[model samples]
Target: MTASDDPVLTEVTGRTGRLTLNRPRALNALTHPMVRRIAETLDAWEHDPAVRTVVLTGAGARGLCAGGDIRAVHDDIRAGGGAASAAFWRDEYRLNARIARYPKPYVAFMDGIVMGGGVGVSAHGTVRIVTERTRLAMPETGIGFVPDVGGTHLLALAPGELGTYLALTGQPVGAGDALRCGLADHFVPAGRLPDLLTALAGRDVHDVLADFVGEAPPGRLDAHRAWIDHAFAADTVEEIVDRLLGSGRPAAQEAAAALLAASPTSLKVTLAALRGAPGLGPLEAVLEQEYRVSCAALSAPDLAEGIRAQVIDKDRTPRWSPASLAEVTDDDVARFFAPPAGRPLRLATGAAPQEVPW
Candidate 1:
């Protein structure tokens, strides 16, 4: 591919090694090759004494990344049982884990529409910066998939039931909410980012951030926490919906509607994933579990159908197989927890967290 065609653009400026996701037309959505490229670059940069920091951003004005190229994944699923898609996720999740524990600073420009795989890449980094334009989400359920890319680990770590709330609804949150949820570290103005980028190329992040970090305007989630913590705290998705519907608040009712609109099986499985994530140990263990869940989802009917309805067909109506939360039985959700038939993603492998010297 030519320069314009390269999905991931890499360059070095002063002490910063930069990665720019280049698919502007597709909102810089990631492909398997793009995932591999990012992993390869990080591996090279970690040992390069000249590269003091690594920065990731997108080339487009639309977003940092919309997500992994799910349309490609959807097509792969339809063609041959999602073997390629599974392989893509293995590497993607590995990169997510690597980002989380990188020896050197990993700064992500979490500006504009960042979702799904977008969250995987940026949210895991050491220095995650969000601007007013940031629209961040883990919208896996809407596509009949569970949160992968170590998403459950990040969301599960969110205060109270905020993670459960975000994972179930797949709603986008702004800079304030992202910071509140521990998904991002700093908020900077969009206009100021150009100058900030200039300073970051050669200067220390702490000194550079001291000049640019400022208050994020208020977000809506903090206001609704009382009800969210209570309603989503329920043990089951059924009870969660019933509590929301019965809560008698408009936002709660709207959340109920959002949950009702998603694939029934996805909602159930997502709840199980969220509930199970807390005990799954480090990000790596949670990622390994997410891999099993994601691979299981590949063979399920809704993965492809959800993508077709929401993306390809643009009909906004997916006819989910289970049809309702009530129809998704315990066994159906349990199937996702079972060990995958293929090779598993085994990061960290039950080892204690390492203290990286960087």
Candidate 2:
């Protein structure tokens, strides 16, 4: 493939080594090889003193990444019970943990449309920048999947029940709300990102950011905190919905509607995952749990069916089995936390290969 034709393009300029996701046509949706490619590049860059800071940016004006190539996972499930898809996630989640603890500064230009797998790659970095154009979410519930790639870890840490609300609704948040949720560090206007990126090659990240960073637009979460915290603090999704519906708040009722439409199994599992995250110790531990939940989802009917409705058919109407929260038994949710038939994700044992941090 020509340089521009590669899925991921890597280049070193001055002290900055940049990795550009090149599949703008797919909104740089990550493939298994693309995941491996990024991990491998980080392996090399981590030890290269010349490459002081590693930068990740997308090649398009549309977004950084849409998510993982889930249609492939759908096909993988249909053909072989999702072994290949599970393997891809195992590696992908490892990469997420690597980014969180990477010794060198790893900067992500989270300009637009960061969701699912997209959130995994950038949000973990030591330096995550969001622009006015940024739209970030962990919209996996809409696809009959639980959020993976340490998403549960980040969302669990969001203030109060904001994490629970986002986990259930799968809504995209702006740069302001992203900052509020601890998903990003600095807010640089979209117009100034090019200038900020160019300066990274020569100056320290903190110094370059000071020149371009601006106050984030006010976020909505702070205003709705009282109702959100109250409604979403319930022990179960059913109660969470009951509280939201009874709150007499338009926005909260809307969130209830969104939850009603999501896959019941996914919604329940996702809640369990989010609730369990804070106790999981670290991002690596949370990822191991997410791996089990994700692999279990492969066997569930909703995953393939969800992808079919939302992606393959573009119908946006998934007929979820177990239809409602009440039908999703405690047994059903507990199964997701169990080990998959395949090997478990073993990330926390021993020293991780790339723990050097600066």
Candidate 3:
């Protein structure tokens, strides 16, 4: 119940520690500083003998986190400085890896708009709590970026070709869909979250979740699973778009519209990454592919134009470099996944590589 003075409030009650992301004005959109703070606090709590568990949540009613502060990333690009942005990504990725394999019990209250970076922070937790208000996504493609923060790993694990669909289109999944898709572990009422946290602080993590049994609200994604799988299974984004347009299914058509409106380069790279990311289980491999694609994306014309149209100009009219997916060459997509000249993608394991299921 104790609160710190930081933008991200860190508090401890008995053996439990809580970290609250506080930036409701922008839906708690994360900045580089916030990422550093969260990582620092987590590192601190990891070694603290008194803290048996850690809980992460956001302040206010709107949501947990919308995503990263793209406006800042855009500005960094505009300044013609790559090191700063690259460094931010390096640190953020490290934090994400730490969270994914944290030693202690880590719980995430994934309420509201948990997208992109929010997903990175919360989805990897031992206990992921979703509510009716939860609307989760890995929507980096919509903003002219590939999903980072170990997003590729989760995308690789999504059912069937649904990962490609969601990654390419940046679709939002509600609470039930999130649970069914393995993004969340438990579903509790939005109003009951505070009480649940209190209960968790007073008891063991598993027991706390076990005691709060409530009927999960119905999900929206399951009904459209077949459509999502079929439409997104196309080999190319253009083909996928065409199928979606031709399917006559309302959901697929809507998804197509969203994809068409997004940055063409982002859509292309995202689809390619999800397709090629399978069988890569280590978090470092996933992050490396994403980092390669991201660094290449910064130099592409579509990224700047996308940010200009969406965030800067607020015009919602972007002129993509290739203009259409058909124009995007296989070489262009390949360049993103290809290792750089000297800096190859490396995994961060100590004495021995961690054994993963797949």
Estimate, for each residue in 5-97, the C-alpha lDDT of model 2 and write its tens digit.
999999998889899998999999999999999999998998898898999999889999999998899899999999999989988998998
Clashes of each: 0, 3, 0
List candidate 3 segments past 4 Å from native. 1-5, 340-345, 350-358
| Candidate 3 TM-score, C-alpha based | 0.93
**Candidate 1 lDDT by residue in tens digits, 1-358:** 6987788989899989999999999999999999999989998998899998999999878889999998998999999899999999888988888888888888999999999999999998889999999999988888898888889888999999999999999999999999999999999998888888899887978778989999998989989999999999999999999999998999999999999999889989888888888897888889888989999999999999999999999999999998888889899999999999987777763222222323
Tens digit of per-residue lDDT, candidate 3, span 81-185: 455666677667777777878888899999999998899889888889999899999877766778887887887787877777778878898888888877888
Determine the backbone clash count of candidate 2.
Answer: 3
Q: lDDT (CA) for every model shown?
A: 0.90, 0.90, 0.81
